[model samples]
Structures are given as structure tokens and as C-alpha cells.
Target: MGNQPETHPNPTIDPKSGFNSETRTFQSLRPKTPLPPLSQPLSVTDYTLSLIPSTSLSATAMIDSDTDTHLSYSVFIRQIKSLSSSLKSLFPSLSKGHVALIISPSSLHVPVLYFSLLSLGVVVAPANPLSTHSELTHHVQLTKPVIAFATSSTSTHIPNLKFGTVLIDSPQFISMLNNFNNSEPPRVEVAQSDVAAILFSSGTTGRVKGVELTHRNFIALTGGFYYTNLMLGNLDEKESNKVSLFTPPLFHVFGFFMMVWTIAFGETLVLMKRFDFEGMLKLVEKYRIDSIPVSPPLVVLLAKSELVNKYDVSSLKIVGCGGAPLGKEVGESFAARFPNVIIEQVT
Candidate 1:
């Protein structure tokens, strides 16, 4: 009776997840850009085109570290149009719903090819250049690509394609990019729901499955992220010359989305044809890369590697780690090492 004198009130438990919950769906206080109607004829390329300022002649769109090539926004757009024209001329039957299987390393022409294909309502199916013959065959059969865009090194892996292969590194393809034509390619109306790209999964859990990301999906996804950044005052430094080094494979979602995001936000991208730990450090020093989008493993490397100490990485202001969860200890170690750099871990 004496022990029962001090009884406490029982806490209510949540029905789901077996714990008391404070999580609630809340509306954002910040206003966002009105999304276009579902019926709107919009392509991601066109959306990206709209982001380019008409007077932005001097803004560098991308830099090719392999060739030391630089393309400004105006030049980049012009190249897209020219390449679209060339693609149309070469494969007259290439139409909406046609797939272009791309197997090439990161290069100056990758972005141009992607934008050009999407502009014409073509579905881009980019794959890893290092994929084996059987893996390549599986991808080819899955996508049923009408045309293939590959390099000389990777083109041998492509089976007999319907429209043949275009070697991205070949002089013929380079010629197409340089040639200016008066006749514009006929405009193809692409709906917002239309499939833009068939990005593949890591195949870690199972066989690789092609993920069909649509125009509206990209629009909504990117728009929300960008708007949130705008709300956070991240866009206030719009005039500052921002540069980012991308270490992930462009075929993967993280790298693919980063490429699109970098372009949309007008940041100069420094692409490495291949990732090498020491090479990455050198590139960071050379380009004065202000930020980098890295995976979790790279985060641990950054935390533990003595290689980072040898490079002049003072310009690096942000280290964005994503695609996997980073441990608290690893993050803490990274923070301790690079106090000046902001380490943002995104799920």
C-alpha cells in the first residue's frame, strides 16, 4: 500500500511503429513555384534551356579536365541544337520513344548528347563504360535501343543496333558538334509524363532494373530541392563563381542528378573521366573546386586518408556525402580534420 502511493500516469503510445510519435505532416511556410499542368508538353532539356539567361554568354557551363576544354552556356546551347540537328539527319527515323543506349566515359560531349537526345523526346539509357560484354548485352536487350552512342573503346560491346553506333570520341562525331547548320530540327512535342531516361539500379540487391524517370518527375524533384535552397538563402550568392567536382559515375542517379542540378543552378562542373583518389586531390587543387559530391566511402577516405594533407584543398568549402548512410564516428573524424569544410550527409 505504501509503495503504490506514488503511481505515475501512463504515456499514450502510437498505433504505428510501436512508439509515441511526434512526427506530423506539416505544410511548408515558404511558397514554391507553381507546377505546370500534367498535360503540359515539357521536356527536361527544354526546362534546362529556360534556365539559361539570354545574356549569359560568359557563364561557363562545363569543363572537361581530360581535354582541358571549356564550354560556356551560349556555346553549350548552340552545340545542343547542332547535335540535335545532326542526330536527326543521321537517323531520320529516330523519333519520340526511340532509345539511345550510351556507353561512354565522362567527356565534354556527354551533357551535349544527353540534352540533344532529350530535346528530341528520345529516351537516354546511359550505362557504365566498364560493364562486361554480357552485362552490356542484357542492357541492350532491355532498352531495345534504336541507336547507340559509345566511344571506340566501348562501341565493340554494343551488339548490332538498329540505327548503328555513333562513336562519341570519333572525329566524325566531333565534326557534327562543330558544324553549324541553318535548318533547325523539327520540334518534337514531349509530354511532362514522357520517359526521359532509363537509369539503372546498382544491382547490389538483385539484377539491375531500369528506372524510368520522367520529365515531370525530374521537374518536381529538382524544383522542390532548388526551391528549398532558395528559401534557405543559398541562391543569394548566385553571382559568386561556384565550382564543383563530381566523383560519382554519371550513369548513377546521384551523379546524373548532380549534373542536371549543377547546370540548372549555373555552377561550373569539373568532370573527371575516371575517379582516382590522388587524381581527385590534384583536380581539386588545380580547379580550386569549391565543393564536391561524394559517396559515403569517399567520406571515410577523406576522414582517414593522409593523401588529402598533401593537396591544396583550401578552396573546398563543402563536402556533400550521399547515396548511403555515414557513421557518426566517421563524420566526426571528417569534421575534426576539415573544420573549414562543411560535411553534409544526405540520404
Candidate 2:
């Protein structure tokens, strides 16, 4: 007889856990997200810019909750382009592969600067604005940044660098944002593998370490959130009007990545310079905020704080908790309180 066809039974998978018994692993149930070609020369800035809807250009991109200032998407993109040109002209020494340290509180300007720097292929190394002199020095040493960006209050902590420091709150920096006469800055060819940002660890175990993230790393991260939301039917027409309040520090991974995702999805982001329980509640009511990315502590506060009752937070639809594990009790308490709201825990 000819060779008999091999016979095998299909592997059993747990529907609830998505576990493959034969493979001894948990399989992903979500559809795979498509990323750009690895060989393509694309920066995270370009990738994110491409995803923004042209129709939303005139929409509000960000709002400073502290100052009640609003920045439109049209103005935001213009500033990025203008600032990119100004930076190149003012500091001819700055170029691709150079690192720039950014130490400032969250504001409208920080996001614009981030996109501009990434487009130039400059590695953004943002540290806490409240970092001690010694800590700042350690970071400077690690990244060897050519220039530093700081606010007047935090610039003193920055050490001397190759190009000195530019205060983000200074008039000169503001002028840079308005330099419309300058032609568009020459684009740099950035590889997916090129180091884009040097983020630091939380320093829980030991000294804080700089973590290098590449352009592709951020592209994939943003793409995952974008495509997943699309697949889950979460990007409906109403989703475009969703407003998000970010209470986390911009330097942290949670806030940093979410900022990127928020821009790519063209959502209005409200930034709080500092976190205050009552202040956060008030902003939610004022802005009609429907989404917030938070930590466990904030989750607990939302679940237990009576201050939440004082404000009209009925608009809140999603609360994303990260940075640590959310206790079952805490999760249940939050769910019980806001039965209609979704509490998404991100590792």
C-alpha cells in the first residue's frame, strides 16, 4: 500500500483562558495587528501623524486643565514643523543620533516638542522635573545628551551639556514655535531599529536605569492599541468625541505611551500639571471627560473617595489602570460603584 496519511486530533483549547493544551501555552484571541515593513524608514512621529484624520485638524488637540488653555490640532502640527526648523537653525550641531534631555512638567508644549525631536531622529530622554541634582547628573552621564530642555523652575537642576539648556517656558522657545517663515526642516532617515527615546525605570529595586526604546517599538505599541480598538468596535463615530484626562506624570511609561496613542486616535487630552483628587474630579465635570489612565492608588481613590460624588462624573466611561496590579477587592469595589464604566487593567 502507498504511504498512509498521518492522522492527528486537533489540539483542545480552553475558550475561557485561550489556552492550548497541546502547546502548553496561552494563545492570543485578538487578531494580529499589521505593522510597517521593518526595512522602511519611518519614525514614530510620521507613523502617528499619518493616522490622524485630516478632518480633525481644526479640533482641539490638548487642553491645560491648570491654565484652561486649549491647543488645536492644526496649531499643534504647525508648531512641530516650525520648531523643528528653528531648532536646526539655532543649533546646527544638533542632528540625528544626538540625545536631548527633557525635564519639565506636563503641558501643551511638551507633546509638540516630543514629536519634533523624534522627527529629527534625536533621542528624547525625559526625566522627572523634581529629580535631585545628583539624580539629574546621573541621567546626563548615562545619556550623554547634546542639549537639554527644561522649564525655568527645573533648569537649575540640569548639568552643563554640549549645547547648554533651553527653557521650554522662555520667550525664545515660544518664538521658535511661531517661526512660520522658515522652510520645512529637512527630514532625517530614521530606521525602525534606531533608538528613539531613553526612558528610565522606576528605581524600585536599585538605581534607576535608562531603557532604550526604538522607533519601531513605539510604532508597534501605538499600532496595537489602534488596531485592537478598531477590531473591538471601540472606534465608532462617538469614539472620536471621547475626551481623556491624564493624571499621570508625562515621564512615566503609562503616560508617555498613552499620550502617543491619544494623538494617533485624535482624542482631546486634558493635562494636569499635578494630581489633586478634588481637582481631578472637577476637571472631569468641566471637560466632560470620558476616559482616564490611572494607577492603582487613583483607582482606589475613584472607588472609595467621597469626592467623586461631589462632581458630575457620569460622563466617565473607561478607567485604565496600570503600573501595578489592581487588587481584586479594589477592582470589585470600583466596578460595583461605576457599574456602567469599564475598568481595564494593563500590565
Candidate 3:
């Protein structure tokens, strides 16, 4: 949290402005402002927006592609500010507890959309794009979301999901972005125990059951390990970190929290929709990537992929693995392939 300003002012600040008779001039002063925590009733989405006027710190979400990028840290937060401008008006009659589902490929849109839902004191259920039609429909039906924002990447799959999926990358979405305002949305009061996210353990443990990770759980993960920079140490050259090549799916908890939130730390995440041995290696070498958070299965491919030896991956410092166990032999193979890359497990 080095630059993550621990203190913020109040959200509702009313300054008194009146003519000072003694001084014979107009005077005004504002009291201590609301410093709401990102997960608080106001949500970090709004907190992120408040920082935009200060400087341009980026929180980029790359849904793949080198140029098709949106929002760095500050910019990302600002974009969130823009998106939240029409919250209640967008869904006037819905309860504050009802969620707004976001299924987009634009990395910029994901955090703001999700956090905006959370800020309203609603629960979030992220459906994986790779999930089958039945799987996607099951989660949708199970949760019964009120509003949804989805990308065309898998539009055909949820053709009849009984929800309005705001096409964020389409002409309509562009118009929405262009016409969006910066006014804050109606904030809701949330408790620490409120469910911030619902994560499912990978099928390794059989059918996935939604693991209700509350706001407290999210705070601990970020405040405890991730924000401490356990994975990005290798990314640092002298004093700053390097851009990371992200090949994991955004829906996976490993990618969503671990990689997605890494943006606020002033790091770049280069996303690849899905892992391709050759393609991933090319990007790593191309970007001179500093860090990567991946799975064990993919690690094996990264270890054995001809691209490892075919190109330069010397820039890589650490490989963070989650969602499964990596065998000693496989770990050794990965170590042998990239001696500079340290492997860490979160199982």
C-alpha cells in the first residue's frame, strides 16, 4: 500500500459559504472528509475516481491484445467513475441488493462494473466464459441477476438467459461511454460480513460450490499477501516493476483478484484470452515480462514449450501458481527451464 493513501476524506462534505461580516468578504471551509474504504458502503470504485484529479496512475485490465487496452490505475478508476454515473437511473426499480452482472472482455470495464455492484451492497457472481452453456445458464438462473454487461466474445451462449447484457464494446457501449457523466451513484451501507465475491474451487474437489468470500475475506487477501508485493518482487528492476503477461481467464479467482487487482499497484497486465504455448512464450519474450500468475497445468506447458528456449524469457522473475497442486518433478522441470523464475503456491 506504499502509494495507496491509507486515509481518504468523507464522501458527503458540505462546506459552509457565507459572508464574513467582520472580514467583509466571502469565506468557506470544509471539515474532515469521508475516507471511506474501497469496500465500504461507497465501495473502492468511487474511492478510485476521487484520485483521478491528482495524477494519472493506471489500473489496466488487458483482455488480450497489445493495443486494445483501457484504463491504467487512475484512468481505470476514473472510467469506473464514468460508468457509475447512471447507476440508479440505469435500474431505477431494482433493489440495491440485486447485482449487476458484467461479462466483458474489456479489462477496463470489469473492475468498475464489479465494484460498482459491490458498492451498492450487492453480491457478485462471475461466470467464466469457458463455462458451457448449461454451466453459464445454471449460475445465471441460480443468482437471477437484475442487470448484466456482457461482451460479444460468448454472446451466442447466453442467447436466452433472460437478462439484458449491455454490449460494452459495441457502438451502443461506445455511445454509453461517450455520454456517461461523473456524478456519484447512490451509495449503500454495507457490513464487513457482506459477501463481496463468490469464488468456486476448481473442479479438482468435485462439483464447484460457491465459496462466499466476504468483503473481509477480500480485504485480508489484498491487505495481507498481494498488496505486500509477494509476487511482483521479480518485476522490480531497480525500484519499479515490469509489465506482466497474463494468460489466465478473468473469471477464475486466481486471475480476477490476483491479476486484476494488481493494476492498482501501478503494474501492467498483458492478457491473452487463453493460454497457447507458442503465443504465451512469444508475448513473454516480446514484452520482457517481469511476473506471471498461472496454474500448474499451464506451468507444465510453459516448462516444456519450445518457445521457452526459442525466445528470451530472462525478464521473468516469478511464476505464481494457484487452483491446483504442482508436482515436485514438474516444479523441478519449470525450475530447470527458467532458473530465474521462482515458483510459489497458494493452495
Between candidates 1 and 2, the one scoring higher on TM-score is 2
Please give, for residues 284-305, the per-residue lDDT of candidate 1 as tens digits: 9999999999988898898899
- Among these predictions, the greatest lDDT belongs to 2
Question: Which lDDT values do the candidates have, in the order given?
Answer: 0.83, 0.90, 0.61
Candidate 3 differs from the real structure by a C-alpha RMSD in angstroms, to one decimal, of 12.9
Instruction: Give the per-residue lDDT digits (tens) of candidate 3, residues 173-262.
Output: 554444445466565677666777666556576655666776665654544444345333522424454577776666678777765356
Which whole-number lDDT from 0 to 100 does residue 32 have in model 1? 50
Q: If the candidates were sorted by their TM-score against the true structure, best first, what order would they fall in?
A: 2, 1, 3
Q: Estimate, for each residue in 1-347, the C-alpha lDDT of model 2 and write its tens digit.
A: 11222222344766656677988987765556789999999999999988886767888999999889999998999999999999999998799999999999999999999999999999999999999999999998889999999999999988778999999999999999988888998888999999999999988899989999999999999998888777667767444567899998888988899999999988899999998999999999999999999999999999999888899999999999999999999999999999999999976
The stretch of ten residues in a row with the least summed lDDT in candidate 2 is 1-10
| True lDDT of residue 86, candidate 3 | 53
Quick one: ranking by lDDT, best first? Answer: 2, 1, 3
TM-score of predicted structure 1: 0.89
True lDDT of residue 100, candidate 3 = 49
C-alpha-based local distance difference test score of model 1: 0.83
